[model samples]
Target: MSRIGRAGFKKQVMFVLTISSFIGALIIGGAVYFFETHQVKKNAAYLIQNTTRQAAVMLNDRLNLVFTQYNKMTDKTSLWRLVNQTYQEEDSPQKYKDILECYRDMKEIYSANSEIMDSLYFATSDGTSIPLYKDMIFEKRKINLEDMFQKNYEENYGYYWLNKHEDQVFPTRKPRYVVSLIQCFKNTKGEAAGYMVLNFKSSYIEKLLEKAQISENGYMMLLSDDGFLGGTHVEEKYRLSEKTIREILHKENENMEKEGFSIYQVPLEINGWILVSVVPVGDLVSSSRQFLVILGITILIILLIAGIFSLVSASMITRPIEKLTERVIEFQTNQNVSFPVDKNMGYEMRILAEGLSKLKERVEELLRQVKEEQEEKSKLELLIVQEQIKPHFLYNTLSSIKQLISMEENQKAEDMCEALSRFYRLGLSDGRDFITIQEEAEHVENYLLIQRYRYAANFDYSINIADDILKVKLLKLSLQPLVENAIYHGIKKKEEFGTIVISGYEENDFIYLKVFDDGIGMSEEELKELQTAVGRGKVREESNHFGLRNVNHRLKLYFGEEAKLVFESTYGMYTQVTMVLPKTKGEKEC
Candidate 1:
């Protein structure tokens, strides 16, 4: 036989094939594992962002229909006189009887939307009024009538469709938390005759939001510059924080991932209100679980097969070796069939290959454990940052009250003292930053109320929240700075009655908090400049432009990039600021 075609060369080729096959299998298996894992996460992110945005837009359209219906009623009425001209005397028996018929007409329109309107009523400047009720009987129910306008009226006057009187110059004629609308009626001579009110059940917004969710189990909210209008659901103790609202409202429509949730937002067509959706990170993890298990099994099988092949190849490469003069072991093959193994051809080479395979397994395992630790670390760091509250707020508040007392303003000082007490009591975070969002809201509310007392009538503020998200937990003072800016910078400088609204609710897996002001909103130039500063992560100390550098830093530091501050404003119109945070429950710190 020719030396080039020797049987020894065939054995060498076989050995080389076996070793290469094993290596190839491992490379293929690992590549597939990592690529699949990344694809799963990518798909999960896409699902949430796409689904939430669609849901928001759909809900906004449906709610706009409801607003349109009420708007049509107003438009139709505005074209005609309020009191029918058939009756000659404005207050004669016939005229009063006709007026009842006229209000009944409005009631009929209200009844058309029984699903949305709890009751319908009309009130005039001089106190002549009408009401439609489900039971037509006055019943007293204990309610924290604290948020009368946002809960009942529009701030409501802030929305060009309604007007506010001093201390709600009108009576509470309907149930709590209804959409309150006030419209005026003029006579043929263009003289003011009277006004009408439409009390829409708050459910009108909630039901639509509930129905339009991409997932059967996700959080959603309806919010405006006046604050949280309503929500469909809330995660346990996961109240949205004001910082979160600033984040979302900073942009018109946003999809973001923060903490343990995927955040989505869409604007409401009627009120510049935003519909925000939150989906939990856990859900995304679960969505890819089955795929992971299958991929894991496939990878294990490939590794097992590779090991078996390697073992078989090692057992087969048995070409006789020249006897070692020094009695050392050696693998032997002829020159015609030579393949380099760095000159090491002993059985120990097979052992080394086995060790390498095992080493790769250990490396993968260590990587998995490291990944898990990274996730846990993220959660722990969140708790740590939340606890990092600045104590100056309490000190400053106490100082302000002390000054008021020293100035001999006893009644105002007493009120300030009470508000300060409540603020601290709610701020009682047990030296931790975490508290139920409801409590955090109350804390911020107390702060705003105190400011309201000090800024008396300069600007009015309101807090609106949905019931389900009340138990949400958040960091302390996340809201105060935004509201403080709204009062001192935006509203105080405005000529008319400016408003400070704080609202929080849950969306999907995240809690959304919004602080909006119907004050001197930022111009495009100023808004862009401020956003640029925030994007650069700078917090300016000046009160002008409602500096939010400090709040931005805190939110980003704790929540990572997902925690965001959003801003939206039209100079001379209104300013909306939002923040998004995790919907973690409980006040426990790590």
Candidate 2:
């Protein structure tokens, strides 16, 4: 081959390579711009759709919970439970103190209406107010002539209203505004007991609607069906200003066939509610313009890379770059990359890039498999651990009973054995998280029976469960641990035959359980410490080798914050642990 001939061949090769490089650069630049733009649009759409769905679900759940809680607060059986306590008429000072403490507790539990609550208060039929304002307690405040209840009482109607009340405790005594939600409370005998008034501060509702996440340039407005706009995040002038939300609906198509819904109907399917969500067209356009600028910047970056490749086109190298593009596409599609022929590929390039891609694929597959295996192992371990704990309790109880039997204490031993059997049976029933109220009560009854032998004549139990509550769902051992706490901490040391009452009933849509014992109880300080421990998830400690911590943890684990163990104990007298459970449908019968 002559030098000129070889040189011409080389030039021809370079020329062909340069043209290929130019085309490749153009294609790659276009691909990058297209891929990035598509990703941006996809991400934005997904974000909007997911956020809206999540917001709806979260808000609906919160609303349902609030309604359930309110129902519990108004339950007929729960109210009757409060009035049916067997306190002595010739009561000691300690008895009065106990009653006062119980009343205070009831007020606190009922007052936990969340940050969005307007106001919550309990009023007796006699116009005595049990007001719970934040941490302050006002017991038995008599209604004055100017009281809001006066008009309602005179009218002989149970109704709520938007009104104001002077803050007697405050120096200003400025009449603060409130939207009252009032209902007539009835006893178990179907007689009116009192009027329960929940006065919600308008500001609280305003904050709730404001705190929720909203789309940019979007606003939330709440209005009554009767043209009364209560609150909104719109302009200050528009806040609380009455606007006919339904009138807007009527204007949309006046002659259209009317369904059950009003024209200004809220977007959601909630009952008796008007929620309006509006976003200005201008804001959407403005935001899309900003998105376009971001897209332009991405295009510029790709164009720069194209310019670099165009300048390098005269060089006869294309295989490495092409291989890299192919690998990237393979990764984007979640497919394994095929190995290119090594005829023109450099050994270093092949090992550096392609080798790493292959390694990543192998690693991902291995991780996925390992994750599944680990989850299975964890589930198995949990079951084994639970089984192990139960047998340990059962073995000890059975052994104690056997020893009693050998000592010719047949009655006590038989009772202990029967209780132990029932307890184990309840623990093993269907292996589900929830049981009926009767089932849970029966479990507690069995536990108390076992304890009775342990502390014979030391304490007596009086259980008063409402018939309506028998079908309500409750955590398996909700009452048992509380009862155990009363016995172990309150009555075990007392010489007298103290009374421990275990009772449960349904209120609006909640199951309320109370385990009370008239024995030696702890001071307020100790109770606070216990609460703090439970709140921090550090309920278990070496000093407290008891099941109360376990009970608190399990309650939280199952029912969230709305339902957990709560208690109030008076030193040297007695302790009462109360549990609140949401009414879950379809709980197993005893």
Q: For each candidate in the order shown, give its overall lDDT on alpha carbons.
A: 0.61, 0.58
Error of 1 at 33 (Å): 5.8
Residue 552 local lDDT, model 2 = 65
Candidate 1, 154: how far from true, in Å?
A: 12
- Work out the TM-score per prediction: 0.39, 0.36
lDDT of 1 by residue, 370-411 (tens): 897676556544533433333665566667778878888788
Model 2: lDDT equals 0.58
Give lDDT for model 1.
0.61
Q: Model 2 clash pairs?
A: 71-508, 75-507, 75-508, 118-200, 118-201, 119-199, 119-200
